[model samples]
Target: MTLPITTTAQVRQSLLDRHEIALLDVREEDPFGQGHPLFAANLPLGRIELDIRSRVPRLDTPIVVYDNGEGLARTAGERLRAIGYTQVSLLQDGLRGWREAGGELFIDVNVPSKSFGELVESQRHTPSLSAEEVKRLLDSSADVVVLDARRFDEYQTMSIPGGTSTPGAELVLRARAQAPNPATQIIVNCAGRTRSIIGTQSLVNAGIPNPVAALRNGTIGWTLAGFALEHGASRRAGTASDPQRAEAAVAARAVADRADVRRADTARLAGFLAESARTTYRFDVRSPEEYLQGHVPGFRNAPGGQLVQETDVSAPVRGARIVLADDDGVRANMSASWLAQMGWEVWVLDGLTADSFSERAPAPPALPAPSRPVQWIAPRALADALAREAPGTTAIIDLTTSANHVKRHIPGAWFVLRTDLPQALARIPRARRYVLTCGSSLLAQYAVDEIAQATGAQVLVLDGGNQAWADAGLPVEAGEQRLASPRTDRYRRPYEGTDNPREAMQAYLDWEFGLVEQLGRDGTHGFRVI
Candidate 1:
């Protein structure tokens, strides 16, 4: 007999009711890392059978599986039934449906505090502070501690007058160190809303005695309000310790921990890969340009900073073993430290490389190609189509971030953040065709690829990305003006893709095997995978 499918509304209400429900997401690591719903555990469909027993524990517990509507939910549901799970169910429309129902999704910046930071930001509001009020505060010269919640580098680049760099997580821990007086009014600011809101709230949540409020909409708002700003000291020195010394200190501290860091030889890694069959993720801790140049065939590109910031999004598999792939140990080891802190069973594959294995060595199976049609339209043709096309029946997507989307974009096009694309697709009429655009041709190509694979909708990439459109001298919009904000809130899925047990196991094994070959080819030197 087939299990029942639950609507997103039903699942959401269940969570509110605090029912004994287990929410499971089954997507690949890279996409899942993008975003997912809060409190939903990731169990990629490929490894559902192996992990369900442990994650849910109670066989009869209500289990709901979902994806971005790529038929992964049905696939996962079937797997659960085969494993004798009696109360398993599928999320009616997967992530897309949940989002259409207005469910919140989250980005996977791996640090729990960072995730909490986002939550604090989402709950933020711009409290009124008029020019007169500002004048009064300045005139009074009261003890107002202005904290810059952005990275140290960003603080140096620019900041509000009298602001000092405190970073995000450190806001609460080091608040007193910076502002010792309990009577001081603590004010946090970042480039924009996210960090400032989180930073201010962190102090409030920690029960600090001072009055804390995020500078309304952060530094942008401050400048807009005609408030003076200041920049930090230039060309600051590097962190006191060397990379190796820092790593050694981190590892030494984890000696007695269950999540201690471990390095695997080629043989050990190969055995792990041989034993597992699932979507295992291998992240190349490098820049996007480096990744595009080709490091490992299947490895995803996740820069170390973003990786650590959004760990939950990238690797949601709580118990699934993680393998870090890097040319050196510094990054890999540092990333591993963060993951270990998050309770992942992580390992670094030592001595792995593409050339180390024999030419005939078996390659991992390729991911199933996206099933959608791929259309390549020249920039001139696309501009012509947009000008003449019926606006309501067709949608143009600027898949870049808000900042880039605002700089210059196609006329009448909507800004579809990469994190919100799936849900945005659901809200858009399926009858309409979609035109996808990005800063460059490569990103647009990838967006088109994923949409086609995940949805049956007719989609096209602006052939040369935005550059092509600009080169053709078509109409463009520019300036700091804000686009209409999306009606639906951003979806945040913590473990949608990365938490698949089967995939995690497979990834771990592959890294182990791959590392062995790499070590033999290039004697381990300036390399780390975290």
Candidate 2:
């Protein structure tokens, strides 16, 4: 079937004119991270069916798929069409075409958001403190609070000594409570630079009287400076008083107004939802713990800081309208302010009450059921079969993300991408019986038909998947030992982990510092700093 082609120039102009568009690189994360157009989102060909609906909710939303001569774009386009995506197209000549058309290629993920953070820092001259300075302050017992502006899980893994888990949106709302005295200093940090810069700037923008500064280069700088980080830390921000919340709401609204973010009441939000021509994202920008207790119906929970740091992942469709909600009013306005400056048509939902949040739990993601029924093998039964059968007679194919596969899997399962089942079948040793499993076996169930077709052997799915194996007290293995596919599903972040090459970490920082210049060259990012 012939597919429409979107020229590189047209894609650029769409971005420049604030028209909704999803430029997708239909390659795995590793390759996509090596190089892609600034606004392009990496939605691998293997995951298109699983992720496209959420990423670009509007079936008729204009989408252009491309790959670097890997021949995946056409197949991706066809799959998208089959899944009811009505306006799918191919990028002319794929990645090479964009390069040839004088479009700038960016390395790493979330280029648009990261570059916008750099632009914010450049335009606003966001204040920052070096790791050494922060260390000295800690040593001196100065009146300061180090706020780690990352998710609680990330903060638990590692954090600055005495640092509290005050994520980005929570910064403005909680800073006053964390350091009630204006004389106390506040240093905000993240695993890397984006959240650090954004979090620190958020407090400044909200007119926090405390002297605020980002931990320059964030935790990476702390590690490089030979400082020891605390692990298993669980310190979290305390609830703000009614007075503090009221004060924060006022300050945050001013910041949002300065950034030109629009306000939408419940009626207006319903109207935005009814508009079929545009895709609108409804998000409750609050802590997950609070979100689970109760949240607005039809709104997903995305913490404010993470939403800004990973906009491509959270809302891939560029120029889509986003409506944010929070009962306190501080988080929504603060998060919307950043989103608006990042070129999104964003609004903060106002006139909310405790009664507005009626949903009590997170909604499950929509997924297609298994194409056909298949036999199921209990985890213990499978373990016994593996022990009793001859070597290579029973094989397990795992379809989890490469990262999760590396973390844990059945002792002898072969990690494989669902899309590469045919190719992978050829590589694995011949077996009389095959079993498929993933994190929960939901995705594996979808692949039962393909594997059964190719092998013609008795195919069974592991009941409850890998999780059940662990729960059943069965043995499992970690590390990448048995692999039928390359582990390219995830691109390792240079800023994560402690053992990364010093040069690589320094290179990452250098790259961020240069993003402003790159943005200037591209001229398509309609970012503004308030």
Candidate 3:
């Protein structure tokens, strides 16, 4: 049980001394997405006692963890020191001591924001287009539009022939409502190359006079230029009340005040929500149906190009204090100028509106979660106990990944891994209402108290798992039908499922063009190419 360890050359010299280290792998998001290192962060050993204090909210910064030796880095370094984590360790020989110390391994799940958007398009040569120069400016009807910036379900999964969605921090307030003719142009695109080079350098760092670019390496360079894309499209970006929404809210508040970004106001945003040892967050970045029709009050909605492409899923506290919000000052100053170029201590809230909401509503939907208080069953009582399949009165089980149990579950529920329920309770046939579920049962109530202390089983957790059985219209059943477990925890990622194989998308863009020489030999990523 002796924990303190480290040295993949001191986590590559504490990310080359820019400092704040997380580097956690703790194995389980599909084998931490089949490889590790480029600033590793998965954090999965069955939700590390429920995502380590909001994913390491500074319990003395340095963490290490790592696994691939199977004995999960000394049980995730004794569960990050029994959940207090005042600097835990253990990597030294995990993932084979980071490839025998030469380091470099990255694959999938936000490899440091996709290798810092391929090192910010190899240092700012960021403008782009090329799918035959945006299909000859849409076959010469010119005055372009395009947009997409990944996530409207990845711009309706594969777009381009006319693009639209507008996700990444809403490209300077929805690219002036999708190109309101400042002699048009725009472009954007994602699904490869970090939200289209941070959504066309977030409308060229918010100076947006409509002439941004980035489609070049997106939709995987329009499927390596053979082109075609468009499945499901459904164009988007429509309401920031365009006509260049007040000059893109004054050039996105002068690029969030030249990236110094502060402006919380309201008495320093009520002393940053009463500090209490610093785990701030407050987000808004508009559009989850405009944060469910009204927002502001202690924010939460995180849309601003998927909050800078999932800042470790919305402020995983890499030194917290994020504020942001947006009654349009060009989307919380272009998402607080890319979360203050990703070092984050960002701000922008100077008066959010719809008159700063939250008098009543806001029940668990402003995302960036942290609530965990499970134990339930209602998706119509697990659809009347799975229509009385009554085999031991019920047996559900699921616990989530195996690629979301082959992309949907419940019809016959078998999946496992709440840390493999004590050898998965002998492949779960012995039930007495062992319900549990995932995809939002919040790790099925931590897999029903570890399958009720490993086999006292009366488990029941399915309240909103399988998205409350597909929002209660019920009836879901996809492949890998009912396996007690074999999907090796999670990895088939290669930027996740959709036609991949253009040699696995050009070997995932040649491993993001060798991640800036492996962040210059894993010299720790405090990454600042902005």
> Each prediction's Cα RMSD?
15.1, 1.7, 22.1
TM agreement with the true structure for every prediction? 0.47, 0.96, 0.34
Query: How well does candidate 1 match the true structure in TM-score terms?
Result: 0.47
Per-model lDDT: 0.56, 0.90, 0.73
Output the lDDT of residue 270, model 3. Answer: 88
List where candidate 2 sits over 4 angstroms from the true fold.
Answer: 369-375, 419-422
Off by over 4 Å in 1: 1-259, 277-279, 284-305, 325-330, 351-372, 384-404, 414-461, 471-473, 479-530
Best to worst by lDDT, what's the order? 2, 3, 1
1-530 per-residue lDDT for model 3 (tens digits): 68788788766765565455677777677777777776577777777766676556556667777788777678768766765667787877788878877887866776777777777788888888777888888989888888877778766766877777877877777676667667788788776778888878878877667688887777776777787787787878787665568878988888778878888777887886666555676777777876777776646677887777767755544556777777768888877776677667787877645556653346443122322345587888768756777556777888777777788887878888766566767876776657787887775775565576666756677777888779888888889857776776766655544677788877887878887778767655666654
Better of 1 and 3 by lDDT: 3
Q: lDDT winner among the candidates?
A: 2
Q: Estimate the TM-score for candidate 2.
A: 0.96
lDDT of 2 by residue, 1-530 (tens): 79999999999999988899999998889898999999889898877767777788898999999999978899889878878889999999999999999999999998988999998899889999999999999999999999999989889888999999998899999999999999999999997799999998999889999999999998888888889989999999999999999999999999999989998999998898899999999899998888999999989999988898889888989989999999897999999999998988899998989999999978777655555797899998998888888899988999999889999998989999875667778889989889989988877887787788888888999989999989999988899898899888888788776677878888899999999999999989988887
Q: After superposition, how far is residue 164 of candidate 1 from its true place, in Å?
A: 11
Candidate 3 lDDT for residue 45:
78
> Candidate 3: misplaced stretches above 4 Å?
1-31, 35-40, 43-55, 60-72, 75-107, 111-141, 145-167, 177-186, 191-217, 225-270, 281-306, 317-322, 325-328, 333-348, 351-501, 506-530
